[model samples]
Target: MTDTQQQSPQARATARIIAPVRHGLTQAGALAVLAGLIWPAQAACIAWVISGWAAGDTALGRTALGAGLFALGGLLRAALDARAGALLFEAADRTIARERAALIEREIRAPGPESSAAVAALAVQKLPMLQPWITRYHVAMTRTRVLPLVFLVLAFSQSWAVGLVLLVAGPLIPLFMALVGMAAEQASRRQLDEIGGMNDMLMDRLSALLDLRLLGAADRAAQDFRDRAEALRDRTMAVLRIAFLSSTVLELFAALGVAMVAVFVGFSLLGEIGFGTWGGQMTLAQGLFLLLIAPEYFQPLRDLAAAWHDRAAGISVVAELDALDAADRVALIGTGAATAPLDGPLSVDLHGAAALPGRAVPLPSLQLRAGEALALTGPSGVGKTTTLAAVAGLVPLAEGRVMVCGQPLDADTADAWRARLAWLPQVPHFPDVTLADFLDPRGTGADPWAALDLVQARHIVDRLPDGLETRLGESGGGVSGGEARRLMLARAVASGGDLILADEPTADLDSETAAQIVAALTGLRDQGRTLLVATHDPALAKALDREIAL
Candidate 1:
């Protein structure tokens, strides 16, 4: 039967809880079971040698045979364990990569701006915590479930009393562990939240450090950051103390259980207690074998106790990832289609379009033919950008159908429609790479320097140390606002999109730059590209072919 077909309900639930590590868990369990089966043979061989010594029958041939069997079992167990560890590590690495990629894709496709700082924390910092859970804790859990039962049945066949003691003590370990785990779960979740908050705080403060310093509040900001770090440290130490205490309690129970089995075997050999071995006295070899296997029976439980904290952390990480993937937030624009180039200039139509669900304003229906240039003019907070976003399909429409190239905009065609258009957001972002690479990632476009020359941004590139080869930081850190705006314009011209959407493209530019932008818009209009610009600039408004006041 297939593995999925053979899985019990409990195993299926576990697989769901840690779906990424299911394959690793199955392979590890099979290896551990093989090792557990070999353990008994190793123990019996040792007992046989000891009993022969006790009987003064130390024949070299029998002794050598037992020694060889013990050695072979030990080597097999070690090899199986090594293989299981390697398999789990690879599985964990792949799982983390897959989760990080999925989170990024979801964020990029989401309708509006998201908390990127929080998403970074989840991907870069929190996601890797699953490694130990899959590699160590998962293996321990599988062994704890499998090896103990195997040892118990073996013990029962020899002496039911020893098996009964293990059976009683085994359940108590998990009982105590569950109680400790409950507290750990709460503490772990708090730690994760605080860490995410700390990351967001650090990013925000760093971005606005100049403003804080100018306002003479830098010292206060520093103090606040210090306080947060100290609080996080204290929380971490508290969790560690609880973890150590739980480990101590579990060890005490495991040690006591093993000691009790040793005492019972000792008494049986001494003829003090003689009522539990199938109405027959145990041979010295049988008693010795039982005693040797006693500690092996509890080893799996001890390993599990050591990995309990990993379980807590892993479950929390999975919960965070699930929250990221849930559709409780705003919807994204498109299906998972690769964007394609437009065949020609396209018309845009907004029928009964309105701002997203919570807004009070309803947008007027409008139609623009191919190659027309229109400007949306409105007061501040009058939904100019919202209208542009609605047109771009970047925000959900409350009661509207947007059509481009005579086809209605839906998830199925959104990506292809977006591909046909170029967007210049009010706030632009550039990846951390050389300027030439940022403008043309595929290295298949027109000369970036030539495009920069068209928008009067060539000087900005020439002034840099490496010219077009100079690397930029996040959000184009080295460039001024005007320079960034011009770069966006340059990129749009180079992209050759049939439709263009520019939001406040001339807001931060000087008069000379504004004139250059006007000329560029004129050139794009003459070339028959449809243009929609959202602006408060009267100069830019006069330059457009038509204006729509919202």
Candidate 2:
């Protein structure tokens, strides 16, 4: 194993995550009831059969009566045990889900550069990996922690010496299982990483399929995908191998311990040892009960050890998510600057600041008035879009404050201020729904055709078989770039917000079509709506009532 894998903190974190709900008392109660009752139930039945046999009575009838009682006891035990298990399972599932959901929310709130990839990993990869682990954690809590403790207590009552040995030594079973668990945690973590890596590789390849085909590297991408898949398969096999080996080792130890106990009981019955002190020589019935219960006592141990794999795997997913979340945080939604309302037309002013990383472009702050259309013009590398983002409440201000209607915008209540704004990103994401749905916020029959007509997108819609009702598959499929941009603008218009921010709305359109989009935007200005459009189109910018040149 690699050194990094060896130093995994998964075990400690998993224990903390599960520690609170590991109800030993609950497990012990169920197990004690099951163990304490099963022995007498079996012994009583056996004794009845022996008596019927020796007395030459109907042994079958006596045996049937005993078996019927045993079955009832078993049924009662099963019900109690199942109820206990259900409690554990539900707690584990709920706790994990709650933690994961909170993590998701935190991630969304504290979005940063690393957030996109991290979120994708958590949503697409870690969630499924946790399923097996949660199941195992639930089972292990009952079997290893609760059942063994109960068994040791009962075994001591039966024979102090046997009980003492069990109470003192039986823990070695879980201790040994824990040793195996530590090893399995590493293996499971590795397996999960490999699986995530393979998934990422496949996604990367698929996203770049056109590039690979164009470059004549499709064969190479296929080979790389195969290698990744194979690596994952091999790691998975290794995890299975370790699980199998650990389970086998635990079973072997349990079998040996049970067998040794049986041998000692046998010798004591034959008077090979001083049994007078240890319950004065166990009866055949007592010895038989011990023999039968020995396996039951250790049964939970084996199950727990085997089930540890699932718990470890599940914990591994949580661990990965936790690690990613630790790197990025979500900005709290409601924690904007202050509470007072801005009184007049909004204006944003930012000073010298850097744009996105790797592009050290200096940005300057500019102001926009409420009554007119303000066009921001700049070169491609300039912060025109960044400036718009800052104004629209998307990007945080570096040095300056944004004022609306002559009052400074408050951070703590940005939501109230944001409600007055409408923003159409450079590339807006639309769900796989109808254009009509996008245009009609109420989802009722509002003629999307009017909005389409405004942006001159009606021509494009007419070409589509379904028109406004046409399903725009993932992210507006079957729609041209200009049509999609127009659709986004239409949605913004439908939102009916006071301040409209459009980023390069004309970016992929012909000059003639672009003019129509600008005209549509100009029409919003005529409606007393404050409009801000970031673009480099000289003619469009000159046509606007006011221009902010960065």
Candidate 3:
């Protein structure tokens, strides 16, 4: 087995992300094991007092000392247990928050492990499952490793028969747990995968709810949701069933071990049996100690069995994290962060660049000087937008290089090159923030009324309840398509970038709306701002300075 495979399930699965928390887990486990070991000393004290009383030497001082020592051990155990619990909870919380933030930040800057909805489900719902495993499983695992052996030695120190019974019973629980864990991990993984899929389905249906209403397919949507829900429920039940079965097995073995020890100790103390004890016969104190210590032997094993399912679930979540790290996606040309503009003049040039990285679908050379407008005219899949994206340094090229604003569009200069341009995508998205914040994302505190008036969109904003402070939904919920396009244009104008890159700016609009958008593009070009538009509209193409057919 590999080094990772040899580690515990949680470690093997989550080591990439959870490394920082492992030390905390170890510290907490040591404290828990220390607390657990005290129970034996406490039991010994109680046994000594009872034996003294049975000998008719019930002195108050002796009894008080024994009781005090037992109480002190109990208090010490409680304190250690409480401290371990606190540390474990803190460690788990810290790990969860850190992973969630890292997942979200990485997704924002790069392509994520899954869809947006699935990523959301994983970050918000699925990740917290690690807490139970971290808090319960690791401590139980520690106890199982230490307490079982210590209890066996202590049992053998008193009676051979009880020790043999514990030895036989203890190993059985771990073996059974190992068997159940294989199936439990599979079930937990399926349940988490289903959750992500269900979230994706819900997001898709909600996004297309209007279209579904128009087509009168709400019943089909509901049925699909019902089926997904049933699958999730079934997967969850499978995990639970495995957990219950393992728990039953653990309890059965534990009860039997304790019962057999009781029989051996009780019969020996009663002179009915004599072969199991070290001194040929069991005393009252030995009998009491054996009965008290028998149950403690199986407690750690029971704890481990109970937490075995949590380990499976936690491992599945960790597996998801590792999957996210390995998933392939579009490579950003630069760091995809805001930076100062590169030193270059206002222009764009593409010399037979490929549409995608590691793909040999090259395009024609396109060049534009300052204050020129060019249209990329092609069919739907003719790489028009891809060409534009390549020029914008949003996608990498296979062979030829793109020069933007006199700078090579590579990782070193892509962010700076992009800072000198504005992009208007086919569909505009707005965060749930005020229009002022959306338009002035850099928080420059500039007046946007001029840009808004320039694009003929001030009238639309003037009618809104909050005007510049209006908070728009992600899809610009209350805004018409043309109006949203106009708002994007205003942002571009306000951005003060010399080049404007628009993709299908005139698509899905009426003649008047399309004309206004076209006029706005023409106006930007006339004002000495460079323009590159990908469009099929003949009017939009004719209005531009020249057209490049892909």
- Looking at candidate 1, the ten consecutive residues that score lowest on lDDT are 8-17
Per-prediction tally of clashes: 0, 18, 0
lDDT of 2 by residue, 386-493 (tens): 776656555554444665655555454466666667787776587767767767754546667766666566777788898777778666788767677777877776
Query: Is 1 or 2 the stronger prediction by lDDT?
Result: 1
Q: What is the lDDT of candidate 1?
A: 0.80
List per-prediction Cα lDDT, in the order shown: 0.80, 0.67, 0.87
Give the range of the ten consecutive residues with the poorest summed lDDT in model 2.
Answer: 352-361
Cα deviation of 32 in candidate 2 (Å)?
9.1
Model 2, position 458, has a per-residue lDDT of 75
- lDDT for each residue of candidate 1 in 502-521, tens digit (9 for 90 to 100): 99888767898777777887
- lDDT tens per residue, model 3, 1-550: 7686577756666575446888988999999999999999999999999999999988999999999999999999999999999999999999889889988877766654377998999899998998898799889999999998998999999888889999998899889989988999999999999999999999999877867988999999999999999999998898888888888887998898899988887788789996987776789998898899889989998899888888889989998887786676556678878899877677777886564423446676989889999999987667888887788787677778888767788999988888888889988899888999888856688999988988888998999999999998898878998999999999998987778999999987999999999999998888889999999899999999999998
From the highest lDDT down, the ranking of the candidates is 3, 1, 2
Question: In model 1, which runs have C-alpha deviations exceeding 4 angstroms?
Answer: 1-15, 18-24, 50-67, 90-102, 111-114, 136-138, 153-168, 200-210, 261-288, 321-327, 334-391, 398-417, 423-493, 498-550
